[model samples]
Each structure stands twice: as structure tokens, then as C-alpha cells.
Target: YQNDIGQREAERGHLARELHDNALHQLLMLKRSVEEPTAALEFPAAYELLVADLRQIISDLRPATLNYGLRPALDGLVDALSGRDENGPAISLDVSGAGESYGPEVDLHAYRIVQQACENALEHAHPRILTIRGRLEPDLIELTVEDDGQGFDVDAQLDLAKLVAHKHFGLAGLYERAAIIGAELQIDSAPGRGTGVRLTWHSRDK
Candidate 1:
């Protein structure tokens, strides 16, 4: 599944680049070369909106920062999701230890897990603070996404039938991603307490 996801992301990236370099560029050129500027003002305005929408789509399909590494990709995720609403949670990321390469596939899966955790928190928990922490060692990589919000029953949510019935795939996806990358995933949450997701991957296991 991870391999399939990676392939899809690659295809999405290619499509995004093509649209940006060819179609979007041509649209821009056409807007600039318009013979009647006043008559085609609406065209320019519409073209700008189109460009912005297309870029956002491209970014959603596959973030470019993932090419650098997991940390930057997570940073981009936090930045994009944070500070959007005044009442939204404050998101922060702290990464320490040796900056080691854990292969692109592993990094991508880890990023997705973190992304899902954050999204779930924001959508359901309504947390005031969301913290993502990463630790990279020579043989082990650990990541934790914690939120100070109204938590849920972890055991009930982890059940497959219950998850499917409720259409809650956030935790399921995190588990799947962690399993795909051979990482140990732990979820801690309670009624009035907060929620925390920790993933630990060992290079030796891989």
C-alpha cells in the first residue's frame, strides 16, 4: 500500500509540474499578451483565480517540501495548518538528534501519520495546543503528535468494526502507515485528558 501511495504521489507530482509549466504558464502568457487590456479585464481576474486554485490543488496532491526530508515536510504541514483561525490550536514542531536519512518511503509514511493525527485533533478534539516532536538517532526514529484537547476512548476507537461503523479512519490510517513502515504505534487518550500518538521505527528492523 505504501508503494502504491508513493507511486500515486509521484504521478501527482508529475501532473502538477506539467500543469504549472505548460498550461498555467501559457494562460499567464495569454493574459499578458491580450490585445485589449480593458475589454479583457475579467479574463485576467479569472485567470488569476484559476492559477491560485490550480496551485493549491497541486500542493495538496503532493507537497514539494517532502523532497527535502520528513522534518521540512512536517514543518510545512504545521505552518499551513496553523494560524489560519483565531480560535484554532497553536501548532508547533520540535525535532532533535542526528539528521539521518530514513529513505523517502519511510519518511513519507511518517509524515502522513503525523498529518492525520493533526487533522484528527483539529477536526474533533478542538485542541488549544498541538505539538509534534521528532527524534532521529543512528538506528531509531521516533515521532510524537500530541494535542491538549478533549480526547476519546482509545480502545473503542481502535476496534475495526467500530471504526468502520463510525467512518473514522484517522486512527486506522495511522496504524496502517506505522505497520507499513514497521514502526510501533501507540495512542494514548481519555475522556477529559488529551491525546498523544507516538511512532517508533528502528532501522535495524527495516
Candidate 2:
């Protein structure tokens, strides 16, 4: 399953690159080449929207910031979510103790876990404020995604059979990813309290 997910991510990145280098480039050129006033105005406007949409799709498939590092990628994620709408929740990142290098797989899984948590909060919790915090050390890395949103019953939701039956895979996927990376996963939530997904990974576990 891990190999399959990695292969799919690779294919997504490849497709994103192809569309960016070929299709997006051609669209820009075509937009610039339009000379007529009306055609130029309309075409450029439409092309701009298309370009923005394509860029978002590409980013969704594979974040470009991941190439730099996990911190930048998580920063990008927070920025993107914060800018999603004028009324969107306030999102913040507070990370300390950097200069830690985990393998690409670990970094990617960590990002995905946070991403999934944030998405779940937005979709289900209607959070007012979403926070992502990280603590990186030589032997330990701790990451948490928390949201001030309407929480659910953690025990009921964590039933694997029930989750599969309900077609709700977000939480399940987080567990799977944590297990894949040998990380300890924890969820803290209640009926009225907010939800928090915390992941801790030890170097020794790797």
C-alpha cells in the first residue's frame, strides 16, 4: 500500500510537470499573441482564469514547495488555506527547532497528515481558527494540527469497521500514514471541544 501510494504520487507529480511545462506554457504564449483589442481582452482574461485553475490543480496533485523542505511546504499549505476565502478560518503555524532532516517519505507523510486534518476540520468542524505546530529535535519530531471547531466522538469515529462502512477515510488514512512511518498518533476531541491530531516520531523508531 505504501509503495502504491508513492507510485501514485510520482505519477501525479509527473502529470503536473507535463501540464505546467507544455499546456500552461502554450496557453500563455497564445494569450500573448492575440493582437485584436476585443479578442486580446477576452482571451487574456479567460486564459488568466484557466491558468490560475490549472496552477491550483497542479499544486493539489503535488505541492511544489515540498521540493524545498517540509517547513516551507507546511507554510505554503497554511497560506493556501488561509487565502481560500475572505471569511476563511485564521490559520497559523508555529514550528521550532529546525535543521532536522527526515527522509522524503517521512516528510511527505507528515505533510499529508496535517493536510488531511485541516481538511477534515474545515469540512466537518467549521473551525474558527486552525493551528499547526511542530517541534523538531535530533531524535524526536512532534507535529500537531488543531482546530477550534465542532468536535465529534473520538471513540465512535475511530471504529475501523464503522469508518469503512461510512466511507469516511480521512481519519483512517491518517492512522495508516502514521503507522507506515512508525509514528505515534493521537486524537483528542469531545462533543463540544475542538479536535487535535498529534503525531510524534522518534529517530530510533526509524
What does candidate 2's lDDT look like per residue over 16-107, in tens digits?
Answer: 78777766876776666585555565676667766776776677666888777778888899988898888989999998876245778888
* Candidate lDDT values, in order: 0.78, 0.80
Q: Ten residues in a row with the worst lDDT in model 2?
A: 2-11
What global local distance difference test value does model 2 have? 0.80
**TM-scores of the candidates in the order shown:** 0.76, 0.76
Candidate 1 lDDT by residue in tens digits, 20-85: 776687577656658666646567665776777677666666677877776778778988898578
